[model samples]
Each structure stands twice: as C-alpha cells, then as structure tokens.
Target: MRSGNIFLKRNEVVFVVILSALLLVVFPMALDSFRLNLVGKYLTYAFVALGLVLCWGNAGILSLGQGIFFGLGGYGMAMFLKLEASSPEHTAIQSTPGIPDFMDWNQITELPAFWLPFHSLTLTIVAILVVPAVFAWIIGVAMFKRRVGGVYFAIITQAIAAILTILIVGQQGYTGGINGITDLRTLKGWDIRTDFAKEVLYFVNVALLLGCLLLAQFVRRSKYGRILVAIRDKEDRVRFSGYDVSNFKIFIFCFASVLAAIGGAMFTLQVGFMSPSFVGIVPSIEMVIYCAVGGRLSLFGAVYGTLFVNYAKTIFSESFPELWLFAMGALFIGVVMAFPNGLAGLWQAYAQPWFDRIGQRGAPRPISPAPISPTAAPAERRT
Candidate 1:
C-alpha cells in the first residue's frame, strides 16, 4: 500500500513539473507581448492564490484581505521606482509629468519624508516582504487569540483592506493621493519600456510563482501542515489534542501574507505602477473569488482559477464591458453549482484517467493479480 502511494505521489509531481514547464516556456513563445503580459499578470496572481490555498484551502481559514498584503508589496516596489525616478534636487515632481497632473493641479511641491526610504531598491524590497508580514502578524494575533473565524474573520479582513485603501488615497503627499504612483521610468537601471526588460520581468514573475508554489507545497507536507489540517477539520478537537491552535492559525496567516506580498511585488514590477484601486475591498473579494473559482482545496485550483478567471475577464470586459460583472456572477454561480470541486477539482476527476492511460501505454503494467486457488484460500485467509 505504501509503495502504491509513493508511485502515485511521484506521478503527480511529474505531471505538475510538465505543466509548469509548458506555462513558463512554451506559452510565452506562442503568445504576443500583450497577451503574454496579461498571462504574466495572471501568473503573479497565481502565486497569491497558491498562498491562499495553504491558509484557506488546506487550513480552513477564510481570509479576505490578501489584497492588502498585495498592495503593500506593490506600493513598496512603486515607492522605490518612483524614488529612483525622482530628481535628486527637488523633493517632488509631477505625478505623471508634463501637465503637472492632479497633484500639481492642487499645488503640491514636495514628496513626503516616508517616501525617501523607498529610493533604495534594497529598502523597497525589504519593506515589500516585511510590511505585509508585520501587518498579518499583528492582525492574526489580535483576531486568532480572540477566537475569530469563519464569516467574522472574512468580514474583518475585508474591512481592513478597505480601510487601507482609503488611508493610502487620503494621504496625498505621501502616497501620491488618489492618483497613487504612476509613470515609472525604470527598475534597477533597466528601461521598463524595453522588450528585454519586459521579458526579464516576465521570467522573474514565473520564477517567483514557482518558488511560492513550492514553498506552499513544503508547508502543506510538513508536520505542522497536518496539524493545520486537523485544526481546520476540528479546531476544538485539535485544541483538546494539546496544540495551541491560535499560534498555528497565526502562522498560516502570516505565511499567506508573505506570499501575497511576493505576488504583489511581482505584479507592480510587471505593470510598473501601483494604485489604491488595485487593493480595495473589491480586489480583496476578487482574490477570494479567484481561490473559490479555482478550487478552494487544491493549489492547482488557485492557480488555474486566477488564470481562467482573468482570461475570461479580459475577453468579457473587452467585448461586453457593461455586462462583465454579470458575466462573472453567472460564471461564479455556474462553477458553484456544476463544479463544486472547482475547475481543478473537475480536472482532477476527469483528466486523471487520460493521464493514467498515457502513462500505462508507455510503461509496463503491474503484475496481474494472482488468481485465488481453492487450496490456498484458507491459508491466505489465515495469514
């Protein structure tokens, strides 16, 4: 039995590797720059979705504030980019250059002091990872220690994201106000507008996505992972088992936050900007929807969910922008009703047979089941 399980696990790993290679290598070659860029965006989201799978899918925690972490990471990178772009002599410049933009229209002269630290790439990257984790740690401790979960947890997270967006937007001088940060020139001395830099960013995003997926898998397979599953299945029972459930919950929460930050950082690097619009309550809900549509229980689901949904969004919003939300709502409903396991779940159910057939065609079949002999039946039963 153990041997059979090991074989199955190996097969699954091989399949995942093959799929990842195709996404990272094959698709970029075939697709145009615009399409590849869009796909890259989905891939970045996939990283965050994978993180959600660890926290919410396997661990049974419903967090809706992943966008906040994402925004923090994005803003971190944006701050650095903006600072790097800014002239050394003057403290502030036009938000979008030339016409003075909105802030210039409002007579703003200098950038806020907080924005100074972001001038350094090293500081920006560090802040991108640390800020989100810190926020998650604080919020997780406060809420989990007080025993918040389920709908309450989700609501609080959603509110937190909303509040953060408002704060960023209201802090005009510091955060670039409602306009946020835009018109980024370059990153680390490389021209962002160049195809070379774009391609580099694309590959970087892919690498980060792969890293995040592997890290989540590691956590999921660890001993603590099993405890998380136990806690998810029965929190009271897990507590009775002498584990500090709150600490475990907090740990997963923080893990998810860090993953979201990575995703966000990759996203801003690709798009070359950040805005409050990117991290509001709606985006937070959308992140949840991505996880739900993909497969709340599976990592593949989260990634596929982000990719598939984003693809659909691009198609629908372009063709029928007015009805995009309605289309999404209908699609969500359809998935909820017809594919309860999510798209990944559906793929698992149906695709495995085809994969097994291909594997079996090339590989030797296991030894046929030994026929039961009448004389040996009693001995076998006794053994």
Candidate 2:
C-alpha cells in the first residue's frame, strides 16, 4: 500500500508539473489581453476554490465565509495601495488635500488609527496573513469546538461574510464604502497601469495559484490529509480513536483562510483595486460553487471548474446579459444532476473505458469454462 501510494504521488506530481508548464507556455501566447486577464482572474479564483476543497471537500467543513478571508487580504493590499497613492507628494497634487476622495467626500480629516500600520509593506503583508488567521482561529474555535457541523456551520460562516460587507460599506471614510478603494497607482512600487506591469501581475497570479495547488496537494496526501478524510467519512470514529478532531479542523480552517487571503491579495493587485462588492455573500457562494462544480476532492478540478465557469460567464454575459444568470443557473443544475462528480470527474469516468481498452490489448485473457469440466462433469451432469 505504501509503495502504491508513493507511485500515485509521483504520478500526481508529474501531472501537475506538465500541466503548469503547458499553461505557462501556451495560454499567454494564444489568448489576447482581455482573455488573458480573464484567465488570470479565474486562476485567482482557482486558488480560493482549492482552499475550499481542502476544508470542505476533505475535512467536511462547509465554510461559507471564505470571502471574509479573501476580503481581509484584498483590503490589506488595497490599504497599502491607497496609502502609497496618497503619499505627501501625491496628496498635494490631488484636487483634495490630506485625504482620499472617499474620505474627503465623507468629511473625514484624520486617517483611522488602524490604517496607519498599512503604510509599511512588511506590516501590510503580516496583516494580510495574521488578520485572516486570527479571524479563522476565532471562528473555528467557536464553532468546531462546540461540534457545529452541517447546515448550521454553513449559515454562520455565510452570515459572517454578509455582515463584513455591510460593515465595510457602512464605514465609508475608512473602508471606501460602496465606491470602494479605487485609483490604485502602484503595487509595492510596480506601476499597475503599464502593460508590462500588468503582465507581471498576471504571472504573479499564476505563480500564486500554482503554489496554492501544490500546497493543497501536499496537505491532501499528508497524515493530516488522512485524518481530514477520516473525519469527513466518520467523525465519531476519529474522535473515538483518541485523535483531537476539532484541532485538525481548526488547522485546516486556518490553512484555508491563509490560502483565501493569498488569492485575494493577488486578485487585488491584478485588478489594481479592492471593493466590498468583491467580498460579499454572492462571491462567497460563487467560490463554493467553483469547488462543487470542479469535483471537490480534485485540486486541478478546482482550477478547471473556476476557469471554465467564469470563462463561460464572460462569454454568456456579453452575448446575453439579461439571461446570463439564468443560463448559468441552468448550467449549474445540469452539472449537479448529470455529473455529481463534476466536469472533471465526468471526464475521468468517460475516459476509463478507453484506458481499460488500452490495457486489455496486451493482457492475457482467462480461459473459458472448458477446463473445469473434467473435475465437475458428474456434478454438472447431475445439475
């Protein structure tokens, strides 16, 4: 069994490496600027989906508040961008002095204390990880320690994301309100406005996505992964086996939060802005659907699912804006009803017959019933 697992792991690694090389080499050349940007966004979403797969797919925790983590990271990066954009020199040139547009519009004179730390790149990066980790830890301890599961946990997490959006919108002066923190000039001194810089951002997004995929794959094959799967299959059994199931859940939850935050930061940098709308309940649900439609246990499934669905959305929206949602809804229903394992699983199942055919070509066939007749002739005759 150990050897088999080792072989399987090697195969998985090879597959990932090959696919990554193919994507890096071919997609950029084939796709135009707009399509490449769209694909990059999808790749960012794939990172979020992979995180969800690690938690919900393997650990049996259907967290619906991943957007909160994503938002935290996005807002973290956005804050830094805003601060850099609003430096003493830039602020002097702007129409309004000593404040951003939203802050000025909202009649604000002083920057909030919390926004001060975001000025430093080091602090901002730390906040991006620490903020989401702390929040996930708190939430996980609160719910998992109490043994909350199923629909109840989902509802609570979804509510958390929902409330976050409202709070961010309500604090217009600090959080940019409904307009969001736009007019981002640079990311860590790289001018986001330039095509070359945008391309660099695109490559960064891909690298992060690949990194997340590899992390998820590693965790999925680790002892922790086995525990997660065991807990998913039989929580009581794992608990009875003397393992601290709640702690495992908490760990995976925190890990997923980190992944979401990373994805969010990449996404914000790519778009050159961040907004509450990007981290609302709708997006949270969409993230969940990405994992579901991709085949929850498959890391690459998450990537494929996000890319396929979002690409489809862009095309359908352009062609039929009024009915795009309806079309997407129908597509989701179709996927759920016809392919419970999702598109990736559907392809695997369909490909199995071909694989079997290939294997059969060189394998020896078993002899038919004639050999048994000598020993069983009397019994056969009696029968």
Candidate 3:
C-alpha cells in the first residue's frame, strides 16, 4: 500500500515515457508548422478530456457543459490580449480608443468595470484560473448538496452553457457577441502571431499537460482516489460510513472545471479567438465524446482520443462536408457499441496484450519445474 506513493507502476512509467517522447520529440520533428499547430489546438481539448477522466470517469459525474468552463478560460485570456491589442494607438480610429473595438462599435464611451482587471496580465491569468473554478464551485455546491446528479445535473449544465452563450451574444459591447474576442496580438510585449511563438506555446502547453497528467496520476493512486471511487460506485454506502460524498463530488467538479479552463486559455492562445459558438452545448458534447472515445478511465487515452476525433473531424469535413456529420455520428455509435472503453480500451484489450505476448515469446523462460523443485528442496532443508 505504501509503495503506491513511492512510484508509478512499471506500465504507467513506460506509458509516460512513450507519451513524452511522442509529444516532445517525434511530433515536433515530423509535423510541419500548420499541422503541428492543429495538433496543439487538439491538445488543448485533451485538457478537458483529462478533467472528465477524473471527474466524470472516476467520480461518476457527467457534465455536458464543460465547454462553459473552456470558454470562460479562453475569454479571460482573450480579454487581456484584446485589451493589449486595443491600446489607444492600436485603436486610434475608434471613438473610444482605449476600450475594446466591440465596445467602441456598440457606441460605449467607457470601459465596463469588469473589463478593468483584465488589463493586467497577472490578473488575467488569475481570472483564467479562478473564474471558472468559482463558477464550478457554485454549480457543484448547489447541485451536489441537493443530491442533483447524473442526467439532471448534465441538463442543468447544458442549460447554463446555453444561457451563457446567449448572454455573451446579447451583450455585444462586453463580450464581442457571437464573434467572440478576436485579433489577439501578444502576451506582455512579445508577439504571439509568429510561427516561433506558436512553437513555444506548443511546448509550454505540452509541459502543462504533462504536469496535469502527473497530478491526476497521483490523485488516482491516493487514498482519496479510493474513497472517491467508492463514493462513485456506492454513494449511499460511503455516506453511511460518515464520508461527505457531496464535498468530494464538488471538489472533483471544480477541479475538472479548472482543467477545462486551462485548456480553453491555451486554445485561445493557439487559436487566437474565443467564440460563443464554442461555449454552447455542441462543443461540450464534443468534449465528452473525446473523453469517451479515448477511454474515459485512461488519462493518456483522453489526449489520444481528442487528437483522433478532431483529426477525423477535420479530415472528414474537408473531403465530405455534407456527410461528415453523418460519418462522425456513425463512428461514435460504432465505437460505443463495439468498444465501449474507447480507443484506450481497445489498445489495452488487444494491442497491449499482443505486444506482451510477443515480448514473452522473445524472452527466455527460466522457471523450469525440475530446477525449482531441486532449489526448493535445499531451501526447505535449511529452513
């Protein structure tokens, strides 16, 4: 039991090594700038998938509004970037030169109070982390304390996403409306539009993702993780045991929200925009699909799933715009029906075992019964 804390299992260690190599070494050397950038965008979604693995997959909480957290994070970062890009000099043509262009276009003379904090990069970063977490906490506390969960909670989250999207769109002066915050130029004084910057951001994103993975792994191996699993499988039993199941649920939910937010912020940096379109029901469902398709129970599967689904989406949409949706729906249906554990499950069930068999065949076997019997007899006499 104590050994769980000291090290990851050998397979986990190998998995991490392979993932690091692929992300850090192989992909960078192989993919061109455009493709690499696209992969980076997909990696951002992986963050949400990782969160789902912890919250929904482990804790048995299914949220259909993850896109809400993602959008908030992206918008928080985008607000700062937009503010920087909307400097007096940059927006000299506008009547309100210092305010965001959307505000100026809407005939607003003064910057709203809420947008003030975003001017400082430090504060923006803080907001990126705090806002979604706070929002999630409120939602979690309200729902979990009342024993609202499963499909009802999912529906509530979806409603929240829809409401938020409408609010952002309706309040054009504040949120950039349906268009979302765009024309993000730089972080501090450094330009982020260049290919060099994208490369740097990709590496930064990967480092953050790896750090999150380790943290998730630690959680999954901890005592709290066991309790959480117990709560998931038998909430009443855990509750009868005097454990505050609601608190655990809230904690995981908020943690998942933060993860989604971080991904959103990274998405904005890499994609250069945050739109209400992404904050709605569809994107949130898409994120869940990513988690599901990757094997929700597997952390590494989340990333692989996000990439696989997004790549499939892009490829299918490019070649067969009309049939892409149908194709995607069919693929999802097939995956759920045939391989409920997603790609990760498929790998574990078949690929990993196949590889293990090959390894066993190649390895020399030394556990002969005659040698073991002779050695055991001598050791038995000494005992």
Candidate 4:
C-alpha cells in the first residue's frame, strides 16, 4: 500500500474531526463548570484506553496492572502539591511546620529523602513522567525477557497492582493511608482548587490528550505497528524473522505505561486528589473494559467508550445504586458477545458503509460508459 494510504482514511478523518469538535468546542459550550470538569475527569481515563489500544489491541499484550503506572504518576504530582501545601507557615501549629499534615499527624518531624526531590516543580514534573516509565521498564524487562506472557503475565500484573494498593493503604504517614493524598491546595503558588484553575487544567488535559492521540495514530500507521500486529498473530514467526520480539513488546508496554502515567497526573490535577482507590485490581480491570468497550483497535472509539461508560456509571449509580454493578456486568458481556470489536466495530460494519454510500450518491456518476458498447465492439471487430 502507498505510504499515504497507510494513515487516516476518510471515515477516520471524519471521526477525528467530530470527536475534536465535541471535546474542544461543543463540550465546553454545552456543559457547566462542574459537568465540564466531570467530563474532563472522564477524558483522563480515555488516555488509559488509548494506551491499551496500542498495547492490548495492536501488540496483544494484556496488562492488568495499568493502575500501578497511573498511581505512580498521580502520586508523584500529589507529593509535590502536598509538599507545597505543607509550607512552614501553612503548618505553623505543627511541631514540624515544613512537613505534610499526614506526616505531622503521624508525629514525623522531617521530610523523607524521597519526598525531598518533589519540592522542586521541575523535578516533580520529571518524576511524574519518569517514575511510571521506569517502573514499567523494569516490569517489562523482567517478564518479556523471561518469555513470560499470556494469562501468567496478566496474573502477575494484577498481583503487582494488588501489592501497590496494599503498600499505599498500609503506610498511613507516608502515603496518606486509605484516604490517599488529599488537601492539595496549590500548584507552584497558583490555587488549583478554584474553578478558573480547573478550567485551565481541563484545556491542558485536552491538549495533552490530543497530543497522545496523534502519537498513537502515527504508531498505528507506521511499519512498526504492522510488526506489532504480526507479532500478535504469530510471535514465533516474528521472532524467527530476526526480530527480537520481546524488545518490541517491552517498548510498547513501556510506552503504554507512560500514556497511563500522563493520564494519572492529569487526573490528580483536575480531581484535586490522588488516591489508592484508583490504583488497584478493580480499577485496572475497569480500565481494560473501557478499551474493550471502545473497540480496542480504535483510538477514537476508546475515548467515546470511556466517556459513555463513565457517564452511564454516574447516572446508574446515582439512581439505581445497587443495580449498577449488575448493569455494568451485563454491558460487558453484551459487548463481548454481540459486538466484539465494540462500538467502533459496529460503526465500521454498518454505519461507515451507509456513509460511504451517501458519499457515492453525491459524487458525479460515470458517463454511462457511452452505452451501445455492443455495436461499438462489433464495429471494432469488423475493422
């Protein structure tokens, strides 16, 4: 196929434009500050779904511990904000005026060595990005290099998520315990709790999400993406073709982790807290469901899926409460049994064809082949 043809198709272009308009223009205009903030929160999950599309959809690597990376990035940012909010004057009543309130509550007198680095805004930003990537790299290298994959890999990832959640919840003073990191007041002297700050953060989140989408699109259209698919279908064949298949898997997994991390950081910024509630087995599986519901293969579909599922959750949980879990279970089962490729798959199978037909109708018809081709052919034969 021509290189130009490898990228976005007409339908895909349309999808991008429509989604962009909804997120950037329509959403801000239609929703109030509070609802718009909620939408922004949902968009953060879309980031996780986007990463899953690359890793699970294309590369066929199912990671059940994505929440670990998300938490790491979120906590990284939270640590900085927590520290800033714990300025000496802010904690003047405490014996140790410069430490976080939780630490002070636990009778801790000084900041931990690890928390010291987060005092710098630049370092905090770097840590938010790097910590998750590094953690992912280590896990990827260990599992992929050892040829561990499939269900086993998934189980191990789930276990890791469980462990991280336990660690965070167990260490009350250091990690804010079950409450997680709360009381975040400022971001480099700017009060983040204000509505205007949230609006700014929402735009920032949207911009970053779009940037991530473009990056994913580029990878999906490149030869490397084809190789990932090949490996997914025939791992041994790809390995025999002189490609270190494990390395590719590791790289893609790390890339996915980074994306999740970015989403986590944005979540912390917008939500005003980072909690262990988001970094555990249940949340990790839910993240996968978002990808699955969106059509794991479709990045744009993933965003819509995240939004749809989250919105439904809010509505159902508020009204039906007890039935929400059952409804969610049924929805998952329905998606798998009826539309394996998800909403995107349904669109491609039904809606896209209708759209194409409409476009064809609008196009100029070929001059009816100058009919009477039967007589014309006979004249040529006689000649």
For all candidates in order, the CA lDDT equals: 0.80, 0.84, 0.91, 0.91
Identify the runs in model 2 with alpha carbons over 4 angstroms from their true place.
1-8, 93-98, 352-383
Candidate 3 deviant stretches above 4 angstroms:
1-6, 359-383
In model 1, the worst 10-residue window by lDDT is: 1-10
Worst 10 residues of 4 by lDDT: 1-10
Clashing pairs in 4: none
lDDT per residue, candidate 4, 76-127, as tens digits? 9899999999988899999889999889899888899999999998998888
lDDT for each residue of candidate 2 in 248-339, tens digit (9 for 90 to 100): 99999999999999888888887878999878888898888888798887888888888888988888888899997687678778777888
In model 3, what is the error at residue 171, expressed in angstroms?
Answer: 0.5
lDDT of 1 at 33: 83
Model 1, residue 44: distance off in Å is: 1.6
Number of the candidate with higher lDDT, 2 or 3 = 3
Clashes of each: 0, 0, 0, 0
Please estimate how well model 1 matches the true structure, expressed as its whole-model Cα lDDT. 0.80
lDDT of 1 at 189: 72
Worst 10 residues of 3 by lDDT: 368-377
Task: Report the C-alpha displacement of residue 99, candidate 1, in angstroms.
Answer: 16
